[model samples]
Target: MKNLKLIVFALLLTFCTTSINAQTADEIITKYIKNIGGAEKLKALKGIKMNMVTNYGGMELPVEMVQLAGGKQYVKLNMQGKEITQMASDGKTLWSTNFMTMSPEKSDAENTENALQSNADFPDAMLDYKAKGYTAEFVGKETKEGTECLKVKFTKKPIKVDGVQTDDVSYYYFETENFLPIATEIEIKAGPMKGKKSNSTMSDYQEVEGIFFPFAINMGGQDLKIKKITLNPVINEKDFAFPAIAAVTAEPAKK
Candidate 1:
């Protein structure tokens, strides 16, 4: 009789432990979506437009961004009265033109071959990371910005960028209480910046169209402060159009 009771107790404990671990990942994901407004609300956002101010190299400049469904994105920056722009759709084609550069350069064909290869970071990507050729795993819990969070690691499949092939790995710290992504650390596997690591922290989330967005972003690497960003009010569809320069270029050249 005592043996039977002990056996049942052991089985119950095992079941509870399995249940807790199973609950953690999905629960965390669901809570995060709710904090940002439910998944339904986020799906309702057809487009996003925002004005941004980025501080880098001891200078602050205004920039703009437009994001749309079907993996389309556009970014514009005004530097010394010159407008620099970059656009991409489904990651297959990209255009980046800057008055500062002697000539406009396109990303290597392999780099822009798929939506996931594009440089733009969209919030929706987090929804179904696996299906997008990304691998994610729980890396336990840690503290960030004075808040406890779950650390998740994501690795991207090999892809070419600028004619050079590379892979990327990133660590995200999601706050436990709110499920908001608080910090990110990324490592690049190839290129001039190969083996380099970058860290970014996100904060100042604001609600827009029932979704939460980080209005401020700061990225740092190798003593390089890429930018401190602050986003503005609206985004327009026309802003995401592909540039004429990109249309003229057939394929990116080999490095």
Candidate 2:
């Protein structure tokens, strides 16, 4: 009977451990959602509009960035009161323009694939991720820069854009105490740095419209500081149009 008890106890312990792990994952995600101001508030979020000052070489440019709920993005750089460069994505296609080119061009096969893996949802892409065809796994706790973090391995739904399949995999480390994302590791699939990993750490979080957002973001050597945030502002589709098309549509009649 002692042997039987031991087997039963082992089974019970196994079940408990599994249950605890599952609960830990669930609670982390749930609390994270709540701490960021509930799921419905985030789901109804339309977009985020922010302005920042970026310095390239000796020129300081004012960058206006707008992000939509569907993953579309519009960014315009103003230099000396004139627009110089602009890029936009309509959640389907990504296009850009440079001051030298002066023409908005569609992304090539390589860039198109990169844009495909971009988060096209509001707030955290991992929120309600199962419904969006992605899966996230809890990787337990780890220390980052001397701070304990709950590491989670997150994957994007494998996508094929333009016959190219991107490795849609990344990992996010959330603060164990607050559950806010502290860092991310993503693989660079193309370009000179192809097949390498890039790490980005997020901090300086600010709350906007009941949601916590990282106001200061740093990746690689690029530093982005949010100067302003407009939540759910009325945005015109024309704002996202390629400047060439937008310019032609805005011209006065040549009577």
Candidate 3:
């Protein structure tokens, strides 16, 4: 009888702990969303355009990024009078410019699909995450950059990697005092950085038309300083389309 009672007690303890963790996660997310201009304002956002700059090899490169609702986005970099499309997705197709070839290349079907699914969480993934079939767990507290933070593990629908379904997960660290997400860590699943952790930190948040944005972002070791942010910017679909390659004109035999 005592053994059964202990078993029941253990089960109850586990349930309570889980309930508390889930509640904490939701509360944190709710506070964060409210801090970042509320849910309605965020949902009403049509698109955003950012003018930024990053230093590469002691050279300052101008960067422009545009992201629209429903998964349309692109990032461009200007270097030495040449503009390069770093990456882009028109909500259906994924593509990027090849530096060596200076030509656009489309991503494989699987990667394109994965990108669309991931970008669908735009504006903010934690907003109505449950409805999007995502889960957020309060994973406890940690210190980042000398500030105490509450860590949350966010998991989304699986994405295909090399034709195999893989877990899509990221960890966000929210400042304990302000509830602002200060850092994010995600695992690199492909390329030379496969199996390594990619870390990004945000700071110097400023408001634009009542919505807060991080003006300074550090991804890996590269820093992007946002100069301006335009909300609801008009976008042209043609900008996201893959450029057509000009056909070579056949020359008549030299007379």
Candidate 4:
């Protein structure tokens, strides 16, 4: 009788363990998308305008960013009542304003391409990933800082420059309990930080338009705190155009 009881307990434990590890990559991604919002809602998402307070070296700086569905984005940082830095893209061309000159110049070709490739997608990268020529693989579960997380890796389609390889990859860590990404890892392939890994932790998830979004992200010592987020805000082409006024003024575009 005692031996029978032990065998039954072992079988039950194995079943539970298998159940916990049974989630496939697609299933995990689907659950993650559903937990935040459904695929249909995410597909209909057109644009977003967000106000962020960035912490840098003990100083808090306010930054306003606008992003459209097809990859156009603009970011403005105000400091000392001045338009200190600005970056904008028109889906194809990328330009930026120098801090001192405030003159618009074409950004680096590699950086521009990277931004264009990454920005033209869902706020959550997992949405329609397969359709976007990307593939994801299940890497099983791991514990992060006392939290059990589902680890997954997604491979970006290979990038090339004059027949040279420049493809990059990204990793995501989603808390098993909520199916929300709490952290991400990436390695820089270009620019000054080439081949260096960067890890960011996300928390403070708040709901916006039936979707959950991380309102806070800590990367190294810098923190991005979202103050406001307006979906489908009306954005004029000029907002992302070069040669703008000395000052930029914007209000949420009427839905």
Tell me the spans in candidate 3 whose CA falls farther than 4 Å from its real position.
249-255
Residue range 46-162, candidate 1, lDDT tens digits: 566667777657677777666665567777777778777754453445656644663555655554564434443454656655567776666789988898989877676666655
lDDT of 3 at 244: 76
The alpha-carbon deviation from the true structure for residue 223 of candidate 1, after best TM-score superposition, in angstroms, is: 13
What are the per-residue Cα lDDT tens digits for candidate 2 across 123-233? 568678778887666778989757799887778766553467664888788897789888888887656887888988888888987888887777875677778888887
- Winner by lDDT: 3
- lDDT (10s digit) by residue, model 4, range 139-181: 7788875789988887876665434667657888889888888
Per-structure clash totals for the candidates: 4, 0, 0, 1
Ranking the candidates on TM-score from highest down gives 3, 4, 2, 1
Off by over 4 Å in 1: 1-23, 86-91, 98-102, 114-123, 130-135, 155-168, 221-242, 245-255
Model 4, position 7, has a per-residue lDDT of: 100
Worst 10 residues of 2 by lDDT: 240-249
- Candidate 3 per-residue lDDT over residues 133-222, each given as its tens digit: 999899999998889999999999999989999999999999987799999999998889999999999999899998899999999989
Task: State each model's CA lDDT, in order.
Answer: 0.66, 0.77, 0.93, 0.81
Could you estimate the TM-score for every candidate? 0.71, 0.80, 0.96, 0.81
Decreasing lDDT order of the candidates: 3, 4, 2, 1
Q: What value of lDDT does candidate 3 attain over all alpha carbons?
A: 0.93
